[model samples]
Target: MILLPTINRSVLLVIPKQPFYDWSNKLFPDLEPTNMADIDEYNSYLLEDELFIDDPKGELKSYWKKIFLNELYEQCMDETTFPALSWKLFTQWFDFHRSAVVSDLTSDPLYTDE
Candidate 1:
Protein backbone atom coordinates (compact mmCIF):
# COMPACT_ATOMS: atom_id res chain seq x y z
CA MET A 1 0.00 0.00 0.00
CA ILE A 2 1.29 3.46 -0.82
CA LEU A 3 1.39 6.07 1.88
CA LEU A 4 -0.19 9.43 1.20
CA PRO A 5 1.84 12.61 1.62
CA THR A 6 0.86 14.91 4.45
CA ILE A 7 -0.27 18.35 3.28
CA ASN A 8 -1.11 21.43 5.26
CA ARG A 9 -4.46 21.89 3.66
CA SER A 10 -8.13 21.57 4.47
CA VAL A 11 -10.99 20.42 2.19
CA LEU A 12 -14.35 21.92 1.51
CA LEU A 13 -16.82 19.99 -0.65
CA VAL A 14 -19.49 22.10 -2.26
CA ILE A 15 -22.65 20.13 -2.98
CA PRO A 16 -25.74 21.44 -4.65
CA LYS A 17 -28.84 20.46 -2.78
CA GLN A 18 -32.45 20.11 -4.04
CA PRO A 19 -33.19 23.81 -3.99
CA PHE A 20 -30.27 24.42 -6.31
CA TYR A 21 -31.50 21.79 -8.76
CA ASP A 22 -35.01 23.19 -8.63
CA TRP A 23 -33.76 26.65 -9.48
CA SER A 24 -31.65 25.33 -12.33
CA ASN A 25 -34.56 23.38 -13.72
CA LYS A 26 -36.81 26.38 -13.46
CA LEU A 27 -34.38 28.29 -15.64
CA PHE A 28 -33.81 25.57 -18.22
CA PRO A 29 -36.39 22.85 -18.12
CA ASP A 30 -35.07 21.16 -21.26
CA LEU A 31 -31.66 20.52 -19.82
CA GLU A 32 -30.88 17.35 -17.94
CA PRO A 33 -31.44 17.86 -14.21
CA THR A 34 -28.87 17.23 -11.51
CA ASN A 35 -29.77 14.38 -9.22
CA MET A 36 -28.73 13.66 -5.65
CA ALA A 37 -27.05 10.42 -6.74
CA ASP A 38 -24.47 12.45 -8.71
CA ILE A 39 -23.59 14.77 -5.84
CA ASP A 40 -20.24 13.02 -5.35
CA GLU A 41 -19.10 14.60 -8.61
CA TYR A 42 -19.24 18.11 -7.16
CA ASN A 43 -16.27 20.41 -6.50
CA SER A 44 -13.73 20.09 -3.69
CA TYR A 45 -11.70 23.12 -2.69
CA LEU A 46 -8.31 22.81 -1.00
CA LEU A 47 -7.52 25.62 1.36
CA GLU A 48 -4.70 26.32 3.84
CA ASP A 49 -5.06 24.60 7.19
CA GLU A 50 -4.37 27.86 9.03
CA LEU A 51 -7.64 29.27 7.79
CA PHE A 52 -9.48 26.84 10.05
CA ILE A 53 -7.21 27.00 13.10
CA ASP A 54 -8.85 29.99 14.79
CA ASP A 55 -12.57 29.46 14.21
CA PRO A 56 -13.22 26.54 11.92
CA LYS A 57 -16.81 27.54 11.46
CA GLY A 58 -16.67 31.32 11.14
CA GLU A 59 -13.32 31.70 9.40
CA LEU A 60 -14.74 30.28 6.14
CA LYS A 61 -17.32 33.04 5.94
CA SER A 62 -14.87 35.46 4.35
CA TYR A 63 -14.32 33.07 1.45
CA TRP A 64 -17.89 31.85 1.00
CA LYS A 65 -18.93 34.59 -1.38
CA LYS A 66 -16.20 33.79 -3.87
CA ILE A 67 -16.80 30.09 -3.54
CA PHE A 68 -20.51 30.58 -4.05
CA LEU A 69 -19.92 32.62 -7.16
CA ASN A 70 -17.61 30.00 -8.55
CA GLU A 71 -20.19 27.29 -8.01
CA LEU A 72 -22.88 29.40 -9.65
CA TYR A 73 -20.63 30.14 -12.59
CA GLU A 74 -19.88 26.48 -13.05
CA GLN A 75 -23.60 25.75 -13.33
CA CYS A 76 -24.31 28.68 -15.62
CA MET A 77 -21.85 31.33 -16.76
CA ASP A 78 -24.52 33.96 -17.25
CA GLU A 79 -24.56 36.09 -14.12
CA THR A 80 -27.94 37.60 -15.05
CA THR A 81 -29.55 34.17 -14.54
CA PHE A 82 -28.31 33.99 -10.95
CA PRO A 83 -30.47 35.17 -8.08
CA ALA A 84 -29.45 37.80 -5.55
CA LEU A 85 -27.01 35.97 -3.33
CA SER A 86 -26.69 36.30 0.42
CA TRP A 87 -25.34 34.23 3.28
CA LYS A 88 -28.78 32.82 3.91
CA LEU A 89 -29.40 31.99 0.23
CA PHE A 90 -26.03 30.31 -0.07
CA THR A 91 -26.77 28.11 2.89
CA GLN A 92 -30.14 27.18 1.47
CA TRP A 93 -28.81 26.39 -2.00
CA PHE A 94 -25.71 24.35 -1.22
CA ASP A 95 -24.31 22.04 1.43
CA PHE A 96 -20.76 22.56 2.60
CA HIS A 97 -18.82 19.55 3.88
CA ARG A 98 -15.52 20.50 5.49
CA SER A 99 -12.51 18.46 6.46
CA ALA A 100 -9.87 19.94 8.78
CA VAL A 101 -7.10 17.73 7.38
CA VAL A 102 -6.12 16.72 3.86
CA SER A 103 -3.53 14.28 2.54
CA ASP A 104 -2.00 14.75 -0.91
CA LEU A 105 -1.50 11.30 -2.34
CA THR A 106 0.43 12.30 -5.44
CA SER A 107 4.25 12.35 -5.49
CA ASP A 108 4.40 15.15 -8.09
CA PRO A 109 4.80 18.76 -7.00
CA LEU A 110 1.64 20.79 -6.60
CA TYR A 111 0.84 23.87 -8.65
CA THR A 112 -2.05 26.29 -9.05
CA ASP A 113 -3.07 28.57 -11.92
CA GLU A 114 -3.51 31.50 -9.60
Candidate 2:
Protein backbone atom coordinates (compact mmCIF):
# COMPACT_ATOMS: atom_id res chain seq x y z
CA MET A 1 0.00 0.00 0.00
CA ILE A 2 1.18 3.52 -0.82
CA LEU A 3 -0.21 6.80 0.41
CA LEU A 4 -0.15 9.95 -1.72
CA PRO A 5 -1.45 13.32 -0.70
CA THR A 6 -3.25 15.44 -3.22
CA ILE A 7 -4.50 19.00 -3.02
CA ASN A 8 -7.73 18.04 -1.30
CA ARG A 9 -7.26 14.48 -0.13
CA SER A 10 -4.91 11.58 0.44
CA VAL A 11 -4.99 8.53 -1.78
CA LEU A 12 -4.17 4.99 -0.77
CA LEU A 13 -3.02 2.57 -3.45
CA VAL A 14 -2.76 -1.09 -2.79
CA ILE A 15 -0.66 -3.44 -4.87
CA PRO A 16 -0.29 -7.19 -4.65
CA LYS A 17 2.82 -7.98 -2.70
CA GLN A 18 4.56 -10.19 -5.24
CA PRO A 19 4.07 -7.86 -8.19
CA PHE A 20 5.01 -4.85 -6.14
CA TYR A 21 8.20 -6.60 -5.14
CA ASP A 22 9.00 -7.42 -8.73
CA TRP A 23 8.30 -3.90 -9.95
CA SER A 24 10.30 -2.42 -7.12
CA ASN A 25 13.25 -4.65 -7.94
CA LYS A 26 13.16 -3.60 -11.56
CA LEU A 27 13.02 0.07 -10.60
CA PHE A 28 15.65 -0.01 -7.87
CA PRO A 29 18.21 -2.67 -8.47
CA ASP A 30 20.89 -1.48 -6.03
CA LEU A 31 18.77 -0.99 -2.92
CA GLU A 32 16.38 -3.17 -0.95
CA PRO A 33 13.81 -3.58 -3.69
CA THR A 34 10.60 -3.02 -1.75
CA ASN A 35 11.51 0.24 -0.07
CA MET A 36 9.55 3.34 -0.98
CA ALA A 37 12.38 5.50 0.31
CA ASP A 38 14.61 4.04 -2.36
CA ILE A 39 12.02 4.79 -4.98
CA ASP A 40 11.63 8.34 -3.76
CA GLU A 41 15.37 8.84 -3.78
CA TYR A 42 15.55 7.53 -7.32
CA ASN A 43 12.80 9.88 -8.39
CA SER A 44 14.64 12.74 -6.76
CA TYR A 45 17.65 12.06 -8.96
CA LEU A 46 15.51 12.35 -12.04
CA LEU A 47 14.86 15.96 -11.05
CA GLU A 48 18.56 16.80 -11.03
CA ASP A 49 20.14 18.79 -13.87
CA GLU A 50 23.07 16.42 -13.98
CA LEU A 51 20.87 13.73 -15.45
CA PHE A 52 20.48 15.72 -18.69
CA ILE A 53 23.86 17.44 -18.87
CA ASP A 54 26.00 14.60 -20.22
CA ASP A 55 25.56 15.44 -23.90
CA PRO A 56 27.28 18.55 -25.17
CA LYS A 57 24.62 18.98 -27.87
CA GLY A 58 21.67 18.60 -25.44
CA GLU A 59 20.30 15.51 -27.26
CA LEU A 60 20.46 13.63 -23.97
CA LYS A 61 18.01 16.04 -22.42
CA SER A 62 15.48 15.40 -25.17
CA TYR A 63 16.10 11.69 -24.88
CA TRP A 64 15.47 11.78 -21.15
CA LYS A 65 12.29 13.76 -21.65
CA LYS A 66 10.97 10.97 -23.85
CA ILE A 67 12.07 8.38 -21.32
CA PHE A 68 10.30 10.23 -18.54
CA LEU A 69 7.13 10.50 -20.58
CA ASN A 70 7.24 6.76 -21.21
CA GLU A 71 7.70 6.13 -17.49
CA LEU A 72 4.77 8.41 -16.74
CA TYR A 73 2.63 6.48 -19.19
CA GLU A 74 3.57 3.21 -17.54
CA GLN A 75 2.85 4.56 -14.09
CA CYS A 76 -0.58 5.71 -15.20
CA MET A 77 -1.41 2.09 -15.99
CA ASP A 78 -1.39 1.31 -12.23
CA GLU A 79 -2.40 3.62 -9.45
CA THR A 80 -0.16 1.82 -7.01
CA THR A 81 2.94 2.99 -8.89
CA PHE A 82 1.59 6.33 -10.04
CA PRO A 83 3.93 9.07 -8.90
CA ALA A 84 1.87 12.10 -9.81
CA LEU A 85 3.85 14.89 -8.20
CA SER A 86 7.17 13.50 -9.29
CA TRP A 87 5.98 13.24 -12.86
CA LYS A 88 4.67 16.79 -12.71
CA LEU A 89 7.98 18.07 -11.45
CA PHE A 90 9.89 16.32 -14.20
CA THR A 91 7.55 17.53 -16.96
CA GLN A 92 7.40 21.06 -15.65
CA TRP A 93 11.15 21.25 -15.70
CA PHE A 94 11.35 19.54 -19.04
CA ASP A 95 8.81 21.85 -20.66
CA PHE A 96 10.33 24.98 -19.20
CA HIS A 97 13.83 24.07 -20.31
CA ARG A 98 12.70 22.90 -23.69
CA SER A 99 10.91 26.15 -24.33
CA ALA A 100 13.87 28.11 -23.12
CA VAL A 101 16.03 26.28 -25.61
CA VAL A 102 13.63 27.09 -28.40
CA SER A 103 13.39 30.71 -27.34
CA ASP A 104 17.13 31.03 -27.30
CA LEU A 105 17.27 29.89 -30.88
CA THR A 106 14.34 31.96 -32.07
CA SER A 107 15.55 35.12 -30.35
CA ASP A 108 18.50 35.23 -32.72
CA PRO A 109 18.09 37.37 -35.86
CA LEU A 110 18.73 34.41 -38.12
CA TYR A 111 15.75 32.49 -36.66
CA THR A 112 13.31 35.36 -36.14
CA ASP A 113 9.67 34.87 -37.07
CA GLU A 114 9.41 38.02 -39.12
TM-score of every candidate relative to the true structure: 0.82, 0.23
Clashes of each: 0, 0
RMSD of each candidate relative to the true structure: 2.6, 18.2
- Model 2 regions more than 4 Å off: 1-35, 38-52, 55-57, 78-88, 91-114
* C-alpha lDDT of residue 39 in model 2: 43
Global lDDT for candidate 2? 0.37
Highest lDDT among the candidates is held by which one?
A: 1
Alpha carbon lDDT at 75, candidate 1: 75
Residue-wise C-alpha lDDT for candidate 1, range 5-96, written one tens digit per residue: 77888888888888887877777888888776666688888887845535534777777888889988887888999999888888888888
Q: Which ten residues in a row have the lowest lDDT in candidate 2?
A: 96-105
User: Model 2, 1-114: lDDT tens per residue?
Assistant: 944321221121122233334654666577665644334322211232223333423534444445554545544455456444343444343322321111122332433253
lDDT of 2 at 86: 46
Q: Score each candidate by Cα lDDT.
A: 0.79, 0.37
